[model samples]
Target: MTAPALIRGYEVVIGLETHAQLSTASKIFSGASTRFGAEPNTQACPVDLALPGTLPVINRGAVERAIRFGLAVGAKVAPLSIFARKNYFYPDLPKGYQISQYEIPVVQGGMVHFFVGDQAKTVHLTRAHLEEDAGKSMHEGLETPGCSGIDLNRAGTPLLEIVTEPDMRSAAEAVAYAKTLHGLVVWLGICDGNMQEGSFRCDANVSVRKPGAPYGTRREIKNLNSFRFLQMAIEAEVHWQIEQLEDGGKIQQATVLFDPNANGGRGATRMMRTKEDAHDYRYFPDPDLPPLVISPAWVDSVRAAMPELPGAMAERFVTADGLPEYDATMVTQSLAFARYYEAARDASQAPKLVANWLMGEVSKRLNAEDRDIADAPVAPATLAALIGRVQDGTVSNNAAKQVFDALWTGEGRDVDAIIEAKGLKQMNDTGALEKIVDEVIAANAKSVEEYKSGKDKAFNALVGQVMKASKGKANPAQAGELLKARLA
Candidate 1:
């Protein structure tokens, strides 16, 4: 009766197949718009719908984009790749087959190095290819007394299918790799990285193998949108499959889908014959679209145009700002966040002081309101001014907190005006605060006796009396120092 291992004595192996919808105005094969959430089938065209005599023309922008991704990851962009039809029967698929690159993809072989906690793990890339996305189906109306609705807006959108080798060992590693990939795509401007809109989607290939044995059959979980869901689904699926095998059942090699609404991965799935052979989708060199030949000059130009990615930004933040790794990680989670900190720090008189306030006070406010850094109410210059007032002893920390509240709620106009109008100036006057301190010591005779008898009770009482006497304007640090001096 020991703790049952999720991977058991089996080695956990994971591969990810990600479909990132390219950021373009038009669809891959048609001139139909690629915008999300238009009227159902509004974005569809004759080619998107697979009508007879409709020929698929590859989008040149998408092809160039796929090669750009290959160059970014230090991969080889294949000069010759064949487009094939992936035959599948689903209401979502307008055509009987999906036009995708099979044997020869546009990009082949890359590696993604991502952090799992503090350690780095690399998910070796098997291939990345260009394809078109299918339409979306709404099951909500089907369960009710209504017809199932189909949205063809997503159909024919350019999709880059990035397939990774089985390198991940845990769910955390899987999520890390996904996040890194998402960031890279967004940084490259190749994809919008909008997971909620299904622009960036993931299908995880997870298998649990016994030590020194052939790989076990894996269930492919499809279309995981959120990072939290990605971890939850993988954890549940890996353990569920392991338990099934431990109970003397065979691991089914088919596709599965994740449902957060389900009770502990109690989701339903249909049986599919997993294919080991290259699917005979009748692949042929695209006649409509010529071969996509990329030159070294183009690759270098694109690389030069690439922005500073999250990994590089984080490293610089730690080195240049002298911040902790965790602090840097929190700040660089979004590009907006990194920019916000830099702006605030540059505006502040004390840079590290600004960082501390940002990491503590600003972050707390953002978390409570669930707001992003881009949407912050307080401007960088204004926030820096407020922090400066506290550091310069013009305002107490307590008063600064009040100012911060007013600032957060968009009250009191501006930082200087509000501080002046509210009379929140700190009292560091020794003559005034010392009298209050003496009065407190005389009033709290028993507490003072407790301190004289080697207790700390009297010290806080004196500090409280000083704060109250100054109308809560006394600088707490200066008050403590003066009170201790008087006592000595």
Candidate 2:
């Protein structure tokens, strides 16, 4: 296991609770629509509003999605799961209680394997339970003075609450785990993974303790919709807790809110309410809803229909494509990226080359523009052609990058056309390249002597001079070879 991340003299302990809203079209227990951005309270029906004589009927689609997630994570799909009423009084919860799985959950005892900057780590999962989302409390843009509005549009939305053990020891590890989980849910097609639309939300429980001591009091940072905010919030909270302890202050267990704009935009956390234990919610099985049962045949069918998981696909890349483990994992980050890589590899017939460009150049551009692989301007076929030219010694790696930039900026589409227009064809004639190498050797007598005197770096310097004399048009390998021959 990786060493725990230390902050000053303390160790940070972080656990995350992620709420992934199911992709079902309707609410979990009602027929009301689950679409986002609807007008307030319009999508809510009588069952969602808990009107008298109204009863909830389980949505089969939601259960199926929960099953899909359980299988994807290699978790146990409980043959029978019970729904409980978690009593809480909140304005947005029209039912006055949330129908959720408490003691018994659908998915249990799984592990999320991911890498935090090349260090492999595994975070154990506590449980994933099926639940219904509460409505939104619109605190802004209200007509009534000094009053807030309640939007019931999101009420009764199906959600899978995934809880993790306190396994993360740093903010970076937590963010990495969250991102991996987000990608997996979207890959499985269970959740939309749209944080901006509230389709996925994270709550971080952060605490700090000295090395080799018992766990410290944890504060839950709620409703973190963005990964950036998640890391920043945990860091801010961790620092605050450590400082409090150093100054003879104790951390109080509570629910906290992270305001990114606070503390001059560096972000800070403040207490929202004291954290409540499970018993405080008064959990009890709902008498109205029957226990959910799944058969072996149903699980087997779902497994057969599921796509090849990301981990398995990554292993295939390593074995079949001759890619390194790290590269394979990176290429399989998302389904679209993996498909793009496979297409490029097949077209170019160079798996390692395609993997390098995809992870290095393509990823660099995508990250800079904050875009997805699906939205990349350079099509897989076009990228394959570029790689082919490089493999055929038509263009050097540097020249190919220039061609890629042109293609990315819409300057040109055809790789060869761009290469010709920019005069980037590599020097292939041995006579001309030999002449350039002789000229470089003659002018750089000092480097030649240094190389003859057994300085390996001087040989590289001579090769560099040869390429410079040829205006970077000479093939680098050929230049090095010619330089070596002349030096000998």
Candidate 3:
């Protein structure tokens, strides 16, 4: 990988701080439910509301999840960590000071490896700390335009804030890192990874500097919920920073919001507020909660129960199934997709064929229908059966597509049944196929003479005629072979 084209002689640098809401049933410090979409403040309890006499109690499940993520990333799970009081004032924060990790964090020093196209890249992790989510402030489309309402239902939700070193140079690399991290968390069952519902969110710190120059002043973009938006926002921000510098303007350190609707969908970002430093937060250890201590025995227990990671699984696919690295990576993108691919591969015993159909036709249809592989209309076994027919020369590739369409639309449950009903079964009888080939050769004398004179297109034309005579039931490869034999 070469560096992306310079933006006004400056290189865009990005670091991401992603918040993955833990899939725990209750809040990090309270018994309040962590479910989304509840009425405003309905889920907030006495502790979440920060009422007097209520003290914070850490959720064990949330800690266990953070440990699991640390192990997944090969990060160091600190034997002991402290929670700090991050002093801040906002309507959404029921507690004046948010509880988070500062000096010491639970997980530290890991690297995330991902591929941008065929190029492999790795982003080093700074730290991933445990924290509680703040309540939401709803101001958009309100009856009182100037006033905002607070929804504390999200308050106290468990969150793992994963911070990355400034290793990403372009928007594409940043987005790739974000996506890979998202898939890993979900694959580990620590997060649901639902960007639309705020289960995962990203904050990007972006800056631009001349090559070999010290890091430039950075602006932090907050709460980018989708990968598309993440990429768009970073690009827009980079351009804006470059343009500003060209106009003799200094880049200011601030927190900004990416407005997807701004400039008629050609997204724009606006500074929300000046960026706050760690010192500005007035951090101090929280007195209510004791130090979080994890024993090696407990970490080992969690490790023993961990699932096979995606990278290892992809390598297995490459070595065991004889798939290309790219295909294996695609298959292991998600746990469900990997399982589906393995089932189909095992059933078909044709790794390349299964990979092609799954990545091509199956993925295309799923995207069109907005369905996941788990919810695909055609099951793995069903797909395997279709592939079998194609492999055995029972149907032409075109005819196999027809069978696939029928199976996808529920026209028939069985692959053979669909093939039979649609009369898509190929002409496999050698005598019958040879007779059609001879008829085509005799009927198109001009084409035959052109083919004998070394025109490949003419031979293709004769093969096309043979397929037309067979109503597309002829195996195309077999027909082409027979045509070449006759021409020879």
Candidate 4:
């Protein structure tokens, strides 16, 4: 990646705080159903409601999921961790405080390595702590004027809050890191990675300062639900901060909200409130729940269960398949895509050809139709069959593309059948191809004379004539070789 651009002699610094909702069936401390989209307060249990006699109990499944994430990131899972109550007051927070890991979070230091363009970047991890989600507040469609309602279904949902150090210099790097993280969690099957349903959310901390200067005052952009909005919000925030500093104004630390449809349905951001520090939260160990503990054997078991990671799989693709780095990376972007690529390569024994088709024609069609690789219409075996035909010279590359289109559109099923029906089979008979080449040479006498006079274009024109005479069924490579031999 090129160096991050400077704005008026200032550099942008960014860190991310991401919340991934664990795929547990019930709340972390209570047994209430963790299902989303429930009626208001329907999923909240007595403990979630902070009743007089209810006590919090830790969920084993949630803790196991957190351990899975910690292992995936190469973080140290603390043998013993504590849960503290983060004292805060909000309408949706029934208990006046949230149970979270503060001084001794479960997962300790780690790093996330990702590529922003061709440059590899690493972001250090502060910690990944377990926490419970707060209830949601809805203001739209209220019966009373200027009134809002609360839905506590998400109140006690389990979450793993992954915090990163201020290591990014641009919005692009931050988005790349977020995307990588999203893929990792989804691949691990610990989280659903659904941004639309609030399964995953990002809060970007942005600041700007002179080169080699101390860190600048930062603003937190909260609840960026989409990656596009993440990039845009960080960019807008950076510009806003640079403008403030250039005008000799002090930068303030605060929390802000991005309104993508603000300013008459355009895009802008507004300050929500001043940002809170650790002191403001007044954290203390929770008296209800005991200290969390994990053993080395448990960690080993979790690690053993993980599937092949994306990085390792990509490297294998490069070394074993002789694929370019870009092709390997693209094919391994998701688990399904990687599986599809592997199946095609194994079936066709033409790794490069399969890679090209997947990254080129297959990806193009998928993007145009807005479909995922898992939802692709053409199966891996079907694609491999097409590649095999191209390899064996049963059809030319262009003809193979036509067969592929027919297969993609569900117009035909078998590869050989489609080629036969469309008469796309290449003219591989030596005698027949020689006759066609002789006819083309006789018809293009002037072009042949131009070729003997050392004109390369004339030679190419003669090849095109051969292809045209054969109705585009003759293999271009074979025809070119035959024509050159006859000319000699």
Candidate 5:
């Protein structure tokens, strides 16, 4: 990892704990439905509700997903792991404890590689453990004043809590890591990766210390559901910590909440509770459940079923398609996007052009409309056709953009049809182009004189005038060549 730049004479240290809700039909230890948006408490079964005489049964599907994740990150899938009871007191925790892996988690160690801008960085993973989610405490729209409602619908949802080491040095690196991990899990089909619906979320642990000094007290910001919030909360917390240290105050260890609307909507973090150590939870092996074991055959089967990972596909794009690393990474961000890129590249037989258009115009439009690649108005074949026109000089770069807009806005479907309808074809008629060049030279005598006096800008001005005279139909490179020949 590159050495992180000092921020205000302090080093900003960050780590993330991301909880990805596994895509299983039922809860981790119960038969209750795992579907979202069900009526409150309707999805809770006997084991989820912790009713009398109910024993937990592990879900095979959840275990399979965890194994998949371990393989994806190159983590160690422990042959033997144990489930422990994490004793805690919360209204949403029906069992008064969370069933989780403490001493021995399923996934041992791994690393996530991503780019913090142009600089490549890698964050090492400590572990990813299988756990059951707690219910939500809804404080809004309660019938009684100052009262909150408990919804157990999400109580038993299977979750894989992926913990990263303190490998990030800044907020940008942290967000990048989170995004890359999110894409990987979604690509693997293990998690839905929906932050808005709480299927995936992050807890950021942020701290600051003087250069070459001991690590300062850290605060864990809980439940940052969006990337924007994660960054904002970290920046806000870093500022607060620096200010406190400069004010001769000591930083305390605590778990805090990010209130985006706090301080008149500037966002701020407030104390939730003091940070807890491992002993605070009083972890102990669950007597009702025996030790979880996995054989070598189980790991081999999951490895065989796994699809090509993002890194491998990106490498292929670089080697086979000759795309740059950055472009390859962006196009392979999702499986759908990669498919679209491959289709367009193969159809156009122009790899670089296809990548440029996909990452440039296609991504811009999708982001503007808040749509995914699968929802793009212009199909991959249609984009490839447009790229082909550009390659064959059927349209200039600017004219091709106009055609792209037409296709994107549903003004036309066929690339050639749009080009023809808009009269955007390049002027390849040598005699006509020469005539326009002569007209531009006569009309812009001042620019012609300046060009003779060794001014490059004046020569470009003459070329522009010639293009204008042709009503933007002239191919820019060919027009320049014609003008230069006439001048010589």
Candidate 6:
């Protein structure tokens, strides 16, 4: 049995908490700029700095964006949601407490279809709430043997914390869900969806348990940005939990971090806190901010403005466009790619054919070059035209391949001119094909005689020689027709 098959006895249980930086121009609570990367104290306001009398003023944009997120997930928008003080003392948090939601959040009760590899698992949401981010701490070992710098540029940024139920099964499933969630947020015009700049971050809760056992003691892994590390970390944690169980060591419910380069090829997790040692965080409603209330009419307007979601678009691709789920998912992974695809299809007027060429040949090249769909030179319509040439036998398959390469960078220039210039137009002239076929047959008399004598391989060999002689531009239908007639 395979290694994957061998891990049958264990099942990985996981949940994810994703923190997305909202696109609002102002901070979540203060009027300071939400733009990233400015001078440390430039974006800082009195409230952000936790000054003597700087009361926090709620940014209406942050609250509205949070409501939009709630609507996007089909969640309930709480008419009265209050920001709370999450007390944690750190250099990054200037205030003794970080302003976040404790019990009552802005939104709750939503579900997102989580896909892993190919399996679709629906993960229910516990809540999605708006909160203000704390500042950053940049450590420099040289300055004071472990000194660090603080940048308040990110402090007080508007962040929507989306928390999900522990409904994930494997690492692949978690990563897939993360990606889907990221794409959805970007599509809604709520967040920029940039992970490297700390705009989007995920905290994963993972555990492993047998089919009949109670829930395993879970570990929370923090600050995972990209999907690759998410998968690696989750899988590593699952295996670690299994090993602990097998060794008769109890699994600890605590926060942990993925070193990423820990144990060996696979990484390891370190304990941040035990379940019993977890902090209460002293959650209470904020005094400076009032409960956010959104009107139903406003919610409806946002709902009307919302674009088609990722899951729905993928379904339409399969049902309406007759694409596979995989193909649909790939094309609709990003809104830009999907938009490009739809535009190209409209321009070309080929649905199924264009989808195939795009998701197949064009997408493959784009991925290999690490380029986005916008970077590709072959417009969707132009690809449809090239495929049409192949369908009409105007150019052989090999010749069409060459034309596709030219089209990829040439951006829909004349297909006929490129084909002629490249000498790739199919040679379907009966007289020309017959001469080449005859020449091949004469040169390979033994093979032709064997073909006539009932050897299938010999017939294929003769055909191959004819194809070679024609430089792979022979119209296969015409070549087969004349070759058989003259041979007989």
**Best candidate (score: TM-score):** 2
Worst 10 residues of 5 by lDDT: 113-122
Stretches of candidate 6 exceeding 4 Å from the true structure: 1-8, 114-119, 141-145, 262-267, 272-279, 311-329, 396-423, 430-471, 474-488
Worst 10 residues of 2 by lDDT: 1-10
> In model 2, where do residues sit more than 4 Å from their true spots?
none
For each candidate, give its TM-score against the true structure: 0.78, 0.97, 0.91, 0.86, 0.94, 0.84
Against the true structure, candidate 2 reaches a TM-score of 0.97
Assess each prediction's global lDDT (C-alpha) against the native: 0.79, 0.92, 0.92, 0.91, 0.92, 0.81
lDDT, model 5, position 403: 98
Show model 3 residue runs off by greater than 4 Å: 1-10, 140-146, 435-471
Q: What is candidate 6's CA lDDT for residue 85?
A: 90
**lDDT digits (tens) for residues 213-297 of candidate 3:** 9999999999999888999999999999999999999998999999999888979999999999999999999999999999999
Model 1: lDDT to the true structure: 0.79
Candidate 6 residue lDDT tens string, 1-488? 11222244986788999999999998977888887778667999888999998898888888778888888788999888878898878888999788998788989889886445555567799999888888888876445766678877788999999999987777877888898889888878899988988889999999887876787788899889877789898888888888888989988678888888877767777887664332568788788777777788878877787788877888987898787787788778789888877876676666666777777788789867867777788766677778788778789877887888887766348788898888888886778888898898789989988888999898778778888888888887777777788888
Return the clash pairs for model 2, or none: none
- Model 1 over residues 172-203: C-alpha lDDT tens digits? 88998998888788767899888889889898
- The TM-score that candidate 5 achieves is 0.94
Between which residue pairs do clashes occur in model 4?
1-119
**Clash pairs, model 3 backbone:** none
Between candidates 3 and 4, name the one with more favorable lDDT.
3
Model 4 lDDT-worst window of ten: 260-269
Tell me the RMSD of model 6 versus the true structure.
4.2
TM-score-better candidate, 5 vs 6: 5
Angstrom error of the Cα, residue 219, model 4: value is 1.9
Candidate 2 lDDT, tens digit per residue, 243-296? 999999999999999999998998999999999999999999999999999899
